[model samples]
Target chain A: MTGLVSLFRRLEGPQTLGRGPAFWALFALVLAGALAYPLFSDGYTVGNTVYFFVWVFIALSLSLIWGYGGSLSFGQTAFFGIAGYGYGILTINFGAAYGFTWIALLLAIGMAALVAALLGYFMFFGRIAGVFLGIVTLAVTLMLERFMAQTAGPEWRIGAARLNGFNGMSAMPPLTIPWFGGPIPLFADVGLYYVVLAMLVLVYLGLRILMNSSFGNVIVAIRENPERAEMLGYDIRKYQLITFVIGAALAGLSGVLYTVWGQYITPSSMGMTAASLPLIWVAVGGRSDLTATVIGTLVVLSGFQALTIYGSQYALVFMGVLLVLTVLIAPNGLVLGVIKGITKLVTRRKQEAA
Target chain B: MALLQLRDVNKHFGGLHVTNSVNLVLEQGEIHCLIGPNGAGKSTLFRLILGEHHPGSGQIYFAGEDITTLKSFARIRRGLSVKFQVPGVFKGLSVRQNLEIALQSRLHGAALDKEIDRLLAFLNLEAEQAQLAGNLSHGQKQWLEIGMAIALKPRLLLLDEPTAGMSPEETHMTGEMVRRLNAAGMTVLAIEHDMAFVRQVAQRVTVLHLGQVFAQGSIDEIVADERVAAIYLGQAHA
Candidate 1:
C-alpha cells in the first residue's frame, strides 16, 4: 500500500496536490453540476447553463493566451464572430449539411488561426509587447465589427423586422448526430447542453495536453522572460505566433458552438463588450489554471444572468466590482488564493501536530 | 584563421559611441579575457558580437562567415552562444528542465534526455536537477547559465562576468571549469574585472579604455606594459 502511494505521489510530482487540490475539487464539482443540469434543471435554466459553457471555452482560450502565454489580446471576438459568420455562410448560403458543417467549422478555425498568426507575426516580430499588443488587438476588433456591420447591410439582415443590427441573427440550423438519432434540435435545451458540455471537456483535455508538452514549456519560458528564452535558442517570435493562432482557433471553435446553441450570430459578437468579457473571465479565473478560468466564467455569467432580473445595466457594474476586487485582493485570481489558503492551513496543522 | 573575428566594429547608441571602431579576433581553444573599467563598453562589445546589438558599421565574422546581420537565435544556431552578466535562467522551470530545453534545442527528439543527463553530470547538478531555478543560489544560477551555454556544444562561447557574486571557492571552481572547456576545444571570450582571476585562466588579454582596445598581448606582456599600467591599471608611475 505504501509503495503504491509513493508511486502515485511520484507520478503527480512534488507540491502538485498542495498547489492545486482545491482548484481540482472545484472543477470536478462544477463538471458534476454541468452533467446534472440537463436532468435537474428546467429547459430555460438548462439553456442558460449551455450558454455559460460556451463562454467557458472562450474564457479558457483567453486564459491560455493572456494568462499562460502572456500575450494580452482584445481581438478574440473577431475570430468568434468570423466563425459564426462561417457557420452562417456554410449552412444558409452554401447549403452545407452536417458533415460539411463540421468541415466548414474546421476551415473557419483555420482561417482564424491564419489571422492570428499574421497579426502575431507583425506585432510580436516587430517587438510590440504588453499594452501595445492589447491596443492593436482592440483596434482590430473595432475595425472588424464596423466592417461586418457595413457589409451585412439591410437586405441580408437575419430575421424579418429585425436588421439583425440590434436584434441579431436567428433561425440557425440545429446540429444532427446521425449515429445517435436524426437532427437534434438545438432548441431542445438538453441536447445543446450536452453538446456544449462534451465540447468543453474535450477542449479542456486538449488544452491540458498542450500545456504539458515541451512546446508549452517553451511558451511558459517565453512568458517568464523572452530574452532568456531567446538565449536558450528558442525563436520567441515563432512560438508567440503559434500560441496566438492556437488560442484564436480555440476561440473560433467556441464561437461556432455558441452560434449553434443560441441559434444566432450578431455583429455585437465582434464588439468590444464581447471581446472584453473573455479577458475578464481570465482575470476572475486564475490565469494559469484552466479549471479556474471555467469557474470564473460560470460565476461571472451566472452573476450577470442573476443581475439581469434586476436590470441589464447592473451586470456590467457587478463585473467591474468583481474585476477590481479580484485584482486587488487576489491578483493571481480567486482560485489561486483559495488554493494557497488551503495549503497554508494544511501545512500549519501539520506543523502543530509535529 | 581565428574562430571569431570582429573587424572595425562600430556601435553608436544615438549620440554615444559605445563600441568605437573596435577590432578583435579570437582563435580556437583560446581563453581571451577582456578587462576594462566601468563604462568601457566591454558588455556593449559582447552584445554586438552576440548580435543583441547591431553594429552601426563594420563586420563580425564567425568561422569565416559574416554574421553581422544575423539575429541572435540565428547566431546561436551557428554555434555561437552567450552567458549574460546577470544569470539568465527560466525561474519558473526546474534546473533539469532548463538544461533539458537547451539540450532539446541542440539535439531534439531521443538524444535530448541523454545529452541533458550528460550535462547534469558534467555540471555536478544531478542532485539539484529537480529544484526550481529560482531557488538556486546566485553562484549556482551562474553555473547553471554556463552549463546551458555549453549544452549546445557551441564552438565559441561569450561569458560576461561568469564569476560575479560568487564565493572564492565557486570562483575557483568556475575558473577550473573554463580551463577544462578551453582545453577541450571551446573558444571563450570572457569579460572580467578581477585581474587575479583572469591571470589564472586567460592566456591572452585585451584591456579596453573608453571604447577602444587599450592594449592586447600575452597576459604577462600586457601586465608589464608601462603605458597600459599607467592608463588602465591606475599606476601613476609604471
Candidate 2:
C-alpha cells in the first residue's frame, strides 16, 4: 500500500498532501460520524446534516472547476437551479405510476452539462478568460434568476408542473426507489441522510481516483500554462470545455439532491448570492486541495450556522471575517496547513525512529 | 533532404517584416547554433517552423512533407519539441509529476516507470523527485525543463537560449548535456547569446542579420570572418 501511495505521489505528486493511511483513517472516522448522526438526533437535526452534505457536493463542484481545472465561475447556481427545475417539472408531469425519479435525475444532470458545454465552447475558443470568464458565468446566473422569477403566471405552466415564479414551487416529488419489496422513499430524514452520506463518500473516492489519472494531470498542466500544454500537443480548449461541463454536471446533481431534501425549488436559490456561497466555501477551504476544501466548507459553514442561531444579523459579518482571515493568513486554505503540520509530525517521528 | 526545410518563408507583423524571405535548412544529427541581435528574427524563425505563426508566403517542410498548414500541436505530434526562452516548467507540480506529464506527452498509459526512472537518473534529479518545481533553483529549473524537453523524445529539439542566466559552471554543464544528447543521435538546434557556451557546443553556426541568414559556416570560419565579427562584436559585448 505504501509503495502504491509513493508511486502515485511520484506520478501525481505534491499537489496532494497526507494522502496515505493517516488520511484514510480520518476518512473512515468522518464516515462513522455521519452514519451515527441520525441515530442520536431528531428529524429536524437529521435534515440539517443532509443539507450539509448537499453543500459539500456544491463546494466540491466549485473546487473541481476552480482548483483543479483552473477556471473561476460565479454561476454554478445556474446549473444547480436548472437541475432543480428539471426534477420538479418532470416528476410532476410524469406522476407516480412510472416513478421517474432516476429519469428525472438524469434529465437534470444532462440539462446543466449541455448548457455548460455550449457556454464553455464559446468562452474557451473565443479566448475569453480570467475575470471575463467569471463575469460571463455570473451573467448566466443572474439571467436565470430574473427569468425564473418572472414566470409567476397562469401561462407559465409546463405540463402538470406550475412555474410559481417568485412565490416558488412549494412541493415536488419525493426521491423514491422502486424496490422489489415495493417503493421506498429515500427522502425520509434518516434515509435521506444516509443516501447523501454514501453519495458524498462515492464522490470523494471518484474525485481522488480522477485527480491521479492522466486526464487530471493534463488538466492541472493546462491550468498552470495553457500555451505550454498546447505546445506539448494537448488541445487546451477541449480540456477546458470538458472541465466546465463536468463541474456543471456535479452542481446539477447537487441541485437534484437539494430538491429531494427541501421538497421545493425557488428562484432566490439561483441568485448571485447563492452562487457565491460555493466560491466562499472553496476559498476558505483551500481551493486546490480537495480535502482542505471539504474541511473548510464543513467547519466554516457550521460556524456560520451556529452564528445564525445566536444572532442572524452577525452571521454574515463573521463569515466575511473568516474569509478575510483565510485569504490573508492561509491563502492555500487552513486545512492545507493542518495537513502539512500532520505530515511534518509524522516525518519527524519516522526520522527519530531511524 | 534536410530534416527541416524552410523555402523563402516570409512573415510580417503589420508593417514590420520579422522574417524577410528567409531560407534555411537543418540537416539530421547535427548541432546548429542560431545567433543574432535581439530583432534579427532568430526566434521568429523558430515560431514559423513550429506553426505558431504561419508565413505570409512560402512553405515549411519537415522530414520531407509540407507542414506549412499544420497547427503547433500537430507539428509536435510529428516528433518535434522545443525548450522555450522562458522556464516553462509547471510550478505547482513536483519535478516527478512534471517529468511524468512530459513523458505522457509522447508515450501514453503504460510502464512509464522505466522511462521516468531513466529520466530522473539521467538528469540526476532523483533526490528532488518529490520537491515542488517552484522551489527549485533557477539552474535546477533549467535542467528540469531540459528533462521535460527530452521527455518528449523528439527526433528534433529546438532549444531557445539554454544558458541565458547561468553561471560559468552551470553554462558548461548545460553545454555538456546538449553534447551528450546530440552524441546519442538527437538533432539539436540551439539559440545562444553566450559566445563561450556557443563555441563549447557549436558544430556549425548560422548568423542572422536583419531577418536573413548573413553567413553559415564552421565556428572557427565564422569567428574569423570580418563581416561576422563587425556586426556582432558591438552587440555581443553589450
Candidate 3:
C-alpha cells in the first residue's frame, strides 16, 4: 500500500510539470474526453486520430533519448523499419493462427532493442558525444534505408515473405488477442484506438514514476554532467545504453502499429524525411518533458496532416519553418513554455487572493 | 597505514613532464593541502588520483589496495570521492535533487530523505533546497558540490580549489567544513591557493614545484621555509 502511494506521489516530481489537485482533475477530465471521443466520431476519423497516437510513442522515445539522456539519435526510424519488417516477415511466414501474431510482435520489438543495444554499446563505449553522436546515428539510419531500398530482388524473400524493396512489404496480419470466445482483431479501428490510448496513459504515468525514481535521477544527472556523475560512482555508459534501448523499443512499438494500421511497411518509412519528422515533433513540444512531447506531437501532426490535405507542397516546408521557429523562439519547448507561463500566473493570482 | 599512497608517479603531455616521479602519502583522518605556483601540476595530480588521467608509471594505493588501473567510478565505489576544480553540480537539477542523487546509492526510503535534509542544513542551503543548482551563488554551488561529495561517506575526498572565487568569510566557512569532514574520519587532499584557508584547515602541507614535491611539513614550518616562500608563497605574500 505504501509502495502504491509513493508511486502515485512520485508523479509530481520536479523533472516534469503538472501537479496538485487541479492538475489531476484536469488530467482525469482530459482522459475521460479521450475515452468518449470515438462515440461521437465516424470510423475514419477515429482511425485517423489513432494514427496520431501511434506516432506519440516515437516522439516520446526521442524525448527520452535526446531530451533526458542527452544523445540525439536519428536512428529511431531505423528501429521502426526493422520492427515493421520483422513483424511482416514473421506473420507472413508463420501465419497468425492461435495468436502467434502477438509473439511475432514481441519478437519484432526485441529485435529492435537488440540492434539498439549493440549500436549503443559501440557508440557510447567509444565515447561519442554531441554532434558526432548525431552524425553516427544518422549514418546508421541512412545506411539501413539504402540497404532495404535495394532488396527488391527475388533473393530477398525470407521463407514465404518477400522483401519487395522500394515498393515495400504488405499482407501482414493485424494484431490479435486470444479471447475466451475467439481471437479479436485490432484493425486500426476503435478497438486499436482504445488499446493504444490505454498504453499511452500507462506509459506516461510509468515514465513519470521512472523519472522520479532513483534510476531516473541518475539518468538526468548523467545528462547534466557525466563526469560529475562518474565521480559520484555511476557507470554512465551503462545508463546511457539502457536509456537508448528503452527508447528504441518504444520506437519499435510505433513501427508495429504503423504496419498494422495500413497492413503495409515501406522503405520510405525509414527514409531521410521520415527520420527527421520525429525530431521536429519532439523538439517543437519540448523534448525534456513527456507530457509536452505528447501534446506537441499530436498538435503538430494534426496541423501537418491538414496542410498535406489542403496544400501538400507546403506541408513539409511548414514543418521545417515550425522546427526552426521552435529552435529560435522556444528552444525549451513551446507547449512547456506556455504551460509555465500559465502556472506562474495562477500562482501569482493565488498569492494575491490569499 | 596511510589511507592514500602515490609512489614515483610520472605523467607527460608530449615533451612536457606534468607530474614527475612524485611520491606522496596521506594518513587517515588528516587534512592535507597541496600548494604550488601556476603550472605546478597540483590539479593534474588530483586528476591522477581520481583516475581521470592514469599515471604514466607508478601506482596509487587507497586503503591498502592498488587502485591505479580501476575506472573512476570503480575507485569511487571503493570509497573515493571528488569535488572538481569547477563546480560540477547538476545545474538543471534542484539543490535537494543533487544531494538525493549522491545519497541514493547508499540510502533509500525515509533514510534518503533524512540524509538529504541533513545535507541541505549542513550546507546552509535548506531555504533554497528546491532552487536549481545553476541558480545558486558561486559559494552556494561550491557548498552544494561539497555536500554532494560528503554524502557518499567516502573514505578519501579529493577537492581541487574548493574555495576558488569565494569571499574571505565563505572561504573560512569552507575551511571549517573540511575540518568537520576530517573530524568525521575522512582523509582530505586539497589543492588550494588561499594561505588563510590553508592555515585554517591544513594540519600538514605539501609544496610542489616543477612537478616535484619540493617541501612537506607543518603549515607554520612550510610558511617559515625560505625555499617554499621563494618558489610559490613569495608571490602570494607579494
| Strongest candidate by TM-score | 3
State how far residue B87 of model 3 sits from its true place (Å). 0.6
Clashes (N, CA, C under 3 Å) per candidate: 0, 0, 0
lDDT of 3 by residue, A1-354 (tens): 998998888898878888889989999999999999999998888987899998999999999899988889999999999999999999999988788988998899999999999999999999998899899989888999899899999999999999989999999989888788988988878998998899899988988888888888998999899999999999999999999999999999999989988899989999899999999999999999988999999999999998999887799999999999999999988998888899999999999999
How are the candidates ranked when ordered by lDDT, highest leading? 3, 2, 1
Candidate with the larger TM-score of 1 and 2: 2
Best prediction by DockQ: 3
Q: Any runs in candidate 3 off by more than 4 Å, and if so which?
A: A180-182, B233-238
How close to the true structure is residue A265 of candidate 3, measured as C-alpha lDDT?
92
Model 2 CAPRI rating: medium
Q: After superposition, how far is residue A232 of candidate 3 from its true place, in Å?
A: 0.9
Which regions of candidate 2 are displaced past 4 Å?
Answer: A1-15, A180-182, A310-313, B105-110, B233-238
Cα deviation of A167, candidate 2, in Å: 2.3
Ranking by DockQ: 3, 2, 1
Each prediction's TM-score versus the true structure? 0.88, 0.93, 0.97
- For candidate 2, the TM-score of chain A alone relative to the native chain A: 0.93
Using lDDT, give the best candidate's number.
3
lDDT (Cα, tens digit) per residue for candidate 2, span A1-354: 975664454433345544667676877887898788778899888977778778887788888889888889986899999998888888888854455788888888899999999998999989888889999999999999999999999899999888899987757877887787888877648888887888888877667667777778888998888777877877888888988888898899888888888889899889966887788888988889777888889888888788889897688777778778988998877887777887799899999999
- Candidate 1 per-residue lDDT, tens place, A31-145, comes to 8976876677798878767777777767877888888788888978988887777666665554435556667677767878888888888998999999999999999998988
